[model samples]
Target: VDVMHAAFPNKVPYEIVYDRVVPSMPEKYKPLSRREFLARVMTTLLVPEEKWCLGETKLFLKAGSSLELEDLIALPDEEYGEALFKHLDLAEKKMAAAKSIILAMQAFVYRARFLRVRRGARTIQRIWKAIKLRRVWRAAAERLLEERRGRLAPKRE
Candidate 1:
């Protein structure tokens, strides 16, 4: 445990000593002192109070208790590395899925816009053709009416 503490200071649960704060207890229970708080933490970890001792600035534990604490704190490197890599792989897969969804939405919007523009162009072309046909029909009708009236009128000197 001392070696682990020396090697990996950050990994050890030393915050309790520095912070001097305990986990929340029952509302009826009074606030606990630092030593009592450390004892409570050890009890929760299945280490009896007899197995550990608290001094002015350090805590001492039996060999078995120290081993238990180390086991709880340190995971095998292989397991830790594998879990981290798996999490990253899963995140990357999710990102790819999200990107594909975004692209599909963009394609859908572009297609809808193109269809709207095409429909408007077709409507304009239809209107133009109708206007041209109406002019030609009107001119033809006027010429026919003039010829019929001339034949029906009386002869002039």
Candidate 2:
């Protein structure tokens, strides 16, 4: 194991030669043969597809680095928690941005609606004033026609 560690600082051999890296746990209590120990480590601790790859004669870590079994067992819990915190921080930033966008959209909609209503009101006022002016002009024209007709009529017989 030490030789492999020295030779390939970032890789581990999957062969029985490097099997001593597996530490005995409480359940086993008994000493494990090199093959058994390696099998246990591969099955129970490392996910073959994610953490490491099965090369022809070696296991290549996906992380591009390898550590002793002790380090592997100790680091993950803390690291996973830290990763979650970082993700949460990113999620919060995304949510805040989304909220800001929503608020801006709402403000834009409100302003558009307000301007439309104001325009409608002004249009209504203009139409109403035009109608009143038309009525007044029609009345004046009727009066002028009546005066002209009366003046042109012959005196009563």
lDDT of 1 by residue, 3-102 (tens): 3443322223444332422232333223656566555555545577666666554566755566555653355555433433344346557779999999
Predicted structure with the largest lDDT when compared to the true one: 1
Instruction: In model 1, state the lDDT of residue 105.
Output: 100
Instruction: Kindly list the per-residue Cα lDDT of model 2 for residues 1-157, writing each as its tens digit.
Output: 6434444334555533232323322234236654444444554443453454444565555444344443553445545334423443465577799999999999999999999999999999999999999999999999999899889987677
Identify the runs in model 2 with alpha carbons over 4 angstroms from their true place.
1-81, 147-157
Root-mean-square deviation of every model: 17.8, 14.3
lDDT of 1 at 143: 87
lDDT at position 102, candidate 2: 100
Determine which window of 10 residues in candidate 1 has minimal summed lDDT. Answer: 20-29
Would you list the clashing residue pairs of candidate 1?
none
